[model samples]
Target: MEQEEALDWTIRTRDPDFRDWDAFTRWLEAAPGHAAAYDALMLADADLPALVPAEPLFAGTPANDRGAPASRWRWRWIGGGAIAAALVAALSIGMTNRADIYTVDTRPGEVRVIALDDGTRIEINGGSRLRLDHNDPRFAALDSGEASFTVTHDASDPFRVTVGDTVFEDAGTIFNIVRAGDATRIGVAEGEVIYNPDSDAISLPAGRALREDGRGLTIVSVAPESVASWRQGRLAYDNAPLADVTGDIARSLGIRIVGAPPLRFTGTILLDRDPQRFFARAAPLLGVTARHTRDGWILKERDGPQS
Candidate 1:
């Protein structure tokens, strides 16, 4: 029974995405013999001499294959117990990813795309934080920032994204989500999404958008084609609050923008990595003069602001 359990753990940890570190640590620490047993199986897989097993449990047979070098295997066999303990300590130290959680983050200017095991793809914008489970593909949590999800629909197992206390579940959807400060914005480019399906349910269909903040929930209209447009370096807006527009440019372009949206905007702003180049074009469309300051860019009302 002990050998079988140890064999199971050895095989599981070998998986590239295996991240249930805490449980594995507990199992090893629960019994004194667990670490020795687990390491023995690991050694056998590498065709090295096992510390506890009388013979290599599953060593391969190859005529020309001399086993892994003796110096390396000898060190591992002698130090397996200590090494196992050290691994537990190391995996337990990090607070970012606890238990089965695996975090994916991007730098301010970085964009990343994560492909999950079950054919779901998530494209996270710059300055985004997303979390996924090592075992569950349908679950995701957004700690902060923006992400675009293109989920493969499974009626039996709907894909769910949790933002703060709110939950959004996909129903054959392609959606974009942004969480900034105390505000969350959701837009569905295709299909539908259920907001808290179990209670106070709200359905967001294609071309629909929702924003929630300390104020309350507000539903709005969005252009279906313009959703997740940041992926294509274009931001499309129709009667969008200037605050939302400015927030997006700052987030996607990776710059600090300080301003209050006293007015509404309706236009498209092309993305440019260079701040100077970007504002030169965006300011005209936004009807604001972009001034570079020591801290960041400040958007002041342009003389004769565009109507």
Candidate 2:
């Protein structure tokens, strides 16, 4: 009886002119499972017609034969079949949507490349976490770290990435995004993207980058090649702060760096297979010495002179 009422509500609510939303809300809130049952019926409404033939199910039934015992049994069987068909359809749709959620994570010194069902490709940098929903192929969430995306062209479903409160939407583009603490930096390599925050939306085209922090948003032009350079085992820094660069290196190498003297360096640093070797090469360039401890590498000021 409850299922029957739920099905009735589903049909009524689907009407184009249905306007008793408050009453419907009251009905749904009246019982705990009422809403779930109605939702099942709605899914069945979409899928049951495709799987079950209406002509064969209703064609031979006559309205005047309701008094006969066999006729009553036949009607019950048909009703049961319809409800069963709707339940099956609802379950199938639920499974399909839930199965499309894909999650991938990377450890330090590891990079992963994923080719999604929709032909979109994602390069997840070391120590990054990302979730992609194939049901909504163009939407994803970056929980932490950095990633580069080569989104397939699907005008119907533009690519969108959410990092905290900020959203980056692209029609079809190659872009890189990094999330560190409260700061987010997005760089576009190919095509364009729309950067949206609470206040406004900014259109960023190829060879441009945007950084958002406590102060505000800043836009700058960057070389396309400089974007996602970590894919080639190199990290390029152009006047980036010491804190930011060390943080990136630590994440990439899967190690910890502490006591880094405050100084900024500008150059490309090759990430060798050995984390110690990379640090040994990088430290002296900044006029610092690399000391290896149990925790990780520590950068200290060189005794001679500052670079």
Residue lDDT tens for model 2, 1-307: 6665565565455444455656676777587456556654554455645644433355576755444333443354456676555655565566455444545556776677766668888888878888776467778889888899999977777778999898998857999998888889888999988898235768899999998889998898888888888888888866776777787787778787886677887888887878778877888876688888998788887887654
lDDT of 1 by residue, 115-228 (tens): 788899999987888888767999999999899999999999999999999999999999999999999999999999999898968999999999999999999999998999
TM-scores for the candidates: 0.70, 0.64
Looking at candidate 1, what is the lDDT of residue 22? 61
Candidate 1: 10-residue stretch with minimal lDDT:
48-57
- In terms of lDDT, model 1 sits at 0.78
Task: State each model's C-alpha RMSD to the native.
Answer: 12.6, 18.0
TM-score, candidate number 1? 0.70
- Reference-based lDDT, each prediction: 0.78, 0.73
